[model samples]
Target: MTAGNPTPDTTAEPAPGPESHPEIPWERLSARMVWINLVRLVISVVPGVLATAVLDTPTGPAWPLLVASAVGVSATALACLRFLSTRYRVTGERVERTTGLLVRKYRYVPRDRVRSVDSSARLRHRLAGVRVVHIGSGEARSSFKLDALTAATAEELRRELMPDAAGEPEEEAGRETLGPQPGPHEEVIARFRKPWVLYQMFSVWAVLVVTGPAFGLHWLLQPFGVDLLELVGELVDYERRGFWWSLALCLAVAYPLGFIGLALTFVMSHWDFTLVRTTAKGHPVLLTRRGLLSTRTVHRDETRVRGITFREPLLWRWLGLTRTSVITTGLRQGPDEDSAAGVLPRVRMWEAREVAARVLTGEPSPLEAPLRRHPRGALTRRLVWAACGPAVVTGVLFWLGRTDVLPDRAWLVGVGAWPVTLFAAVFSYLALGHALSGSYLVVRRGAVNRSTVALQHRAVIGWTLRQSIPQRLGRRVTVRIPTPAGERHYVLPDASTRQALAFIKGSTPQLAAQFIGEAESGGRRAAPPP
Candidate 1:
């Protein structure tokens, strides 16, 4: 590799021999994949055994063994068929895979359009010497997978999909070169240690979402005549406990469960975290690699990047941690791949500034500037909007109480409901704010969890002035800044139109000029560009 380009060294490794090849060019998955699939077959087969037991069906040893044999034979045959059917190849321009024995299927992705390449292996897959390869495109929800491949093949595919570090092929005096020369190899900008990964895992309180699995299990068990609540109460004896004791018991049970889930998710998604910066066609490219069980590697051509987002959640902000995401075109169609695209999954706030300065070269730093706060009317609007739901509920309750449809104590519901509603209203209102500083636009929003996005002005594709009746009455307008990256829309929920316009004009004058001068014209009349 040339200056500033550093290739990963694997020189000591031996190459795969012809004996390992199934064909001249195409490749098949590791034999261990068959064993892995057999295990999966066992897992799927267990439910039937359990169902038989639950139904109190009389079963002989021979009958159960027969069932097992039938399922095993079918699963083993299917696994063999799939292994035989699947094949892949990597060439100069494209990577392709073919699968299915009877109903054949084929998929090919051009090397240039490849946005991300990742590999993952669960416990069985790891033991079987195979990994699942995940390939993503720039379009939303466009992803493909190779069910199983050896580690060597996965690496080879990754190299094939990525542009060469040496730069694209160049013309000699007389003839064309070996291949398009690759851009300079990327340099490591940052890498997270185990401690940092731990911090990031703790930063997200996914434990709070643990109720999803618990409740799902509870509902599923209900059909089997099991009262999940009674079972749990029997174990913990919550009825006999005092308020504080119950609280302590719940916390004791919840915290560890939450930690395990969070830790697993963090490790699976962010193992061996590394970030790299390199140049392609003279523009920067950001690459990320991480994942414990399922490794993911993603690359972004900085030339296609429109801006960046700096996110700080409440708990994370207190720990001085932030995540940095990129905004780019051709990214609007994905199914929330922000986690995959995060350049800084977990970095200190100061580190974010440093990385931003490096990655967003020549652009203004929005973090250094003070954000402009929305007018009081914005807060009032949120409060009113939030209050409507509670007010309607309270009204319904009062009417029901007078008509004897509900108990006289129904009025008491508002005592708790009103306070919670007000809190949400006030919190949500307080969370809304926006700022425009030079070539950057910073938006602050979110009620329970706070998010602050700092974006460059050039990324603002169009300006939308949205006003509801209440917003109009309050002399406020919602400004939406749409970009092609991810699902997030940078919005200033309730700001003065004057401030919004001024901010847009300052950040992207071209877009503002068109919006102001031509946007106001009658639909029938075409307004030329300024």
Candidate 2:
């Protein structure tokens, strides 16, 4: 045979095929997920069965129901198995996901767009020798989940995906810690050191436990023709056989027990809790711990942070606990998504401020300083008008009762309306006072929900000062500042023309100059007066 030609016998001997692809270790969902799903299935089926039995539905179709449930469970189990059997191959350049029997899906997630990689192993998952890896990419703005990976494989995958490591001597490896390592500009400004477990349990009880049981009891008793208040009275009598004595005893026992449960839950939730600041591939990584349940690590691009807010809820204030969060661009709407967007786990308010100063602003501003706002009466009048709705409704109800247009038994309307009016008036006054108190508009805007609005001095994209028909009649103005990303506008519902102009001048001097220049140019173009 010629050098390029193969004989029939040579072809039959099997010519070299393309390079064999590496085998990807197939993985399944962690046993924990399986267990959790199983539990959910049981919970679903048991409730349906119980509900059917309670309603005395004909049992004729019971077999079908059972069969359907089993089929569903099997289908889900098979899907998870298929996922586990699927393998991902990561080369020096790209990540590829290949799977499916009849139909196949092959996706490539380039390494350059990957913003972060996270691996987690819950206690149950650890037992099952599985871990979940989350891969986040900026381009697609989505995250990929890889489950049931062996710990070693996870580490290998992480190493492969990690951005090119800074070339450092091998000797430096031994000095580095397993957790995040900070950059030169970043530091752990403060540590939130608390008896976390105690605090967590207390927080859980105070926030949720009491309300849950109270609501449950209220609902359960209502269905049985029982009144909660009456039942409570009876229980009180049973305890001491005397009304006053029983009341005192119940209060004494309930308060301490409630507090104990609160304390325990706090302890459990905050167990081994720690917050750390580190530079991950040059971005600030905030690592928080709250018990062994799971460890949450958040990474933020410092440039994307729009505002930092530190809040101390009334209850947590006493315990020296504070919640901190940031406002950032590209956030999805809704509290849950917003929470995922920029929320930091609850921490001491002071610590939050300190961290913000160090990471966001480079210098700490006093956390207690009151915010700035527009003139007081102007803002208050608008708030008062808004608050008057409830009062007006209450007044109408009271007038109808007094006029006997409604039954005399409805006299309670006037009595109830008194409280409603007082509440509305107080709220209106506070809202108005807050509006008028320029402190509310101060650059640092958040106490409970904090936001700071500041524009680069030279980066003003557009400025508009407008007055609506009502606002014009009322001599009020609304100021809008538009940036490339979006607009930040404020309504000064009541302000004179001069006051509005002056406010704009003080807030954005450059914007005022631009506006004045435009006005002067427009005046020049106007036809000469006759």
Candidate 3:
């Protein structure tokens, strides 16, 4: 509250305003935000103080105090300027942020472009009764952020930005903008089960999180003058006991520790995860809320979602688990923000497909059709590339053996690498496949971390087809489907002219039928050149 004005009673019901008001009065950020900023600065300074204590700095103890005073004065001045200049206003159509002293910065976002509103509070912010607000614009990056605002003010701002379409049929003049409303009529689509989270724990991220740190720790210890490899070598004598015994001991110690870290990561990140769909202002919106320390709430406009992907790993496939994620124009594509994409983290295959129908139109199971496999030539190409590594390794080993640097048996390792690489290459080639199920075009690929992306035909706006000289020889063409969410491609390695025509017509039958018919009437000329 400003010193001169009375604080608005936040608990009291807000008076309704005109549905098509030009703008709300510009609201200044709380003056208390200055204190919050100071507190945050102090918290960040603690790490520097601790580092100085550990490392011998040229500056003495008095230098720390001087530095602290300088920082405090700088922060205080900046906070004063920020509190005075920064102001935000919400209108019927847009949210505006006006700040900066000299040049003046004005950021504006139309309400329709706003995709999601995320709120988070650090310990200091929580104590200060404020939270940082993030407004996502469905872009690759977010530009609007409200650094510190009172919890009530933030909620009020969010509500104003999201007008009640249910209350007012239209945003005409002389109509109320907001009204006392009950929660939206929402049904439980799916809830998180412990078994599902357990399955999610064994994901690709878990493998990296568990083992990456172990290797990193070994490297990190080197800077401290501790030789990890030398210590382990001294502890386990290969001469007295077999090398296999020492290797087994290392695995026994490392794996359990990895599992512990994996479990803890899963619990911390996915605590109280829930997916709920409810109608807001008569429009269906999907809400996903989760996280322990940093809780996140994403309100997705259901209309913006383009499609979904059912990701199945090799081990998870055998266990009958499939991870479901949404492809939305409103959310960024990455693991961290991808949770906004995740409809179901890890669910029974049947359960996932069942829920997918509600989330999307057309066939519930998008992988219904028999996928058209790539040509054998594609497999041969993959094998050639896969053999390159083994070939290089074999050459190096032979050179070493000739120089007496390594035993002759070292070259034999390349022979073992060959079969493994061949198997992997074949597996990857076999996995290259695509299907057309109802209104969805599905593409399944990958060897270890298999992903099956099902995109809605209605969501597709354009198609691009490309064929290389080698791919052309094999009658293979890559078709890229572009949507607002992202671009997804299918490799039709062995497809005949008819199959390729059918695939194109499937996406836009009305648009492509004329061209396809003309080609068909042209006889052999329609067929791709040999």
Candidate 4:
């Protein structure tokens, strides 16, 4: 009660705003963030510090080492202390952060705008016993992060930010979180399996997954005089020998080693994978936690989840394993956007479907629904690219070899690849499909990585029509749907103009409403997708 104000009316409703939630206050980042930053500083300074200490200067070896050490410590301590200036809070209406000492920067995201609550902890941060939290709203610049929070606090914040996850009240059920796994109250939808490891081990294309990172590391170390890729190239050089022999030798060495590396990585990364269903606020949320050394936790509000993608790579699809990822507005779409969005690693198709249904809160998964097959012209278009395209390349190489422009082996190589290309084209044609499944718009395509995505009808913002010279000649058009989630747009390639327009109209009426009547009245009305 204020001194002049007659004791504030006891029953008066709270004035509102910040006063409405007295429990929440501006919170500071964990002090251990200083340790995490210091570790990074030491790692950066050690090499230079050692080189300086090795030089015999007027300041002596010991003095250089000691002085460099002192400077590093001072700089790190001051820089990391910026955590002291940072403060954030979660109010009923917003998630706010305040930073900067002199100028004072304050920013807040409305509670409704928060899309995902993701938390991760690297090895050093784990050693310091802290996790970093990110609250993303699809947009890159608007994302807010909290670094170095206690594991428990990070989990609490994750729950607070994602209010739509459905679950029973913890107080009523008397549940407590244990270790890295979900508490007994949380329902786990999927987990790691040994067969997944073996499936990857037997994969003929595993070399790409294993060597991609090795090549990146080798590139980074090139300035340091490390040339691992060059060494590999020298070993596999085919200039002095038959290309076939060199190819065989390279395959022999890469296959077993690639298998072991990929399997080990698979085991280490997904040793304790778990996809759990939990509740926040009144809505349901999907929470996925995995990894052995560096743990990652992705908390996505069920409402923001626009769809699911079932991706089947060539070899994995043959091996009966499929990779599953969710399409959510909370996740930013970019080159590697789906990497962190994967809800399940490669697993049996049925297991993937079951988990999809569980997360989607439906008994019969949408993937089970029949899809409208593409017209024969689409298949003809694929055959031209798959068969004639390679045949044309082979003919060009043959002509070039006769003209002394390229080696005879180039044409021979094209001959050898023609059959495989044709086979792939046929498989891709078979996979081409699209349909409107109740509340979802389904589009499936791709040969190397056959991906079938089920997007919500309401998530579609608009439609785009594209046609190439060949497509125009064949009277076909490619339709792309623009959405805020996944890849800004999803594509339906080489469908008849009439059918594509019909699909557009079926998914979202207004976009195609203007085009449909004219298209149908102009020609024999296309049969509605069965």
Count clashing residue pairs per candidate. Answer: 15, 18, 0, 12
Q: What is the lDDT of residue 525 in candidate 2?
A: 50
> Best-fitting candidate, measured by lDDT?
4
Ten contiguous residues with the weakest lDDT in model 4:
169-178
TM-score of each: 0.70, 0.56, 0.70, 0.68
Model 3 worst lDDT run, 10 consecutive residues = 171-180
- Report the error of model 2 at residue 415, Å: 6.9
Better of 2 and 4 by TM-score: 4
After superposition, candidate 4 runs with Cα above 4 Å error:
1-33, 37-112, 144-185, 202-254, 332-340, 386-405, 408-417, 468-473, 505-515, 523-530
Ten-residue stretch with the least lDDT total in model 2: 168-177
Model 3: per-residue Cα lDDT over 1-530, one tens digit each:
00011236678434333233544677788767877777667765653555455535333233443455466667767877877888777776667777889968777666767755556676777778786776667553334777778888777766665554655322211111112122457655676567755665554444456467666555544434556677877788756778899877766666666666877766676677766777666766666656667555556566667677777777788788887777766455545324556767677888887777777754456755578876677787789878998999999998999899999779989878999989889878877887788878877787766777777777666555566777667766666665666333333444445566678788777645435555557444442221
Alpha-carbon RMSD, each predicted model: 10.5, 13.7, 11.3, 10.8
Please state the error at residue 71 of candidate 3 in Å: 13
Instruction: State the TM-score for model 4.
Output: 0.68
Tens-digit per-residue lDDT, 1-530, candidate 2? 00111225543333222122455443344345566456546754753464355434342233434454566577657746666456666654456565666676555566554544566666656666667776655333344667656666666666667542433111011011113434555445444456433444444234344546765565434433556766776767764477677866766656666767776654554445444555555445444433435444444443444444454444565567655555343322124212333344455555556665554554334344453343455545545654465567656776787898976556455556555555544433332211111211223322233333333323233556666676666665555544322123322334455564564555555546545444436446542321
Better of 1 and 2 by TM-score: 1
Q: Report every candidate's CA lDDT.
A: 0.65, 0.48, 0.65, 0.71
- lDDT computed for candidate 3: 0.65
User: In model 3, which regions exceed 4 Å deviation?
Assistant: 1-33, 40-112, 164-184, 203-251, 291-294, 313-320, 336-338, 361-364, 368-370, 388-417, 486-496, 517-530
lDDT per residue as tens, model 1, 89-194: 7655556677887797767666666766656666777777677787656543445787787877776766566544435322100111111233479677777666
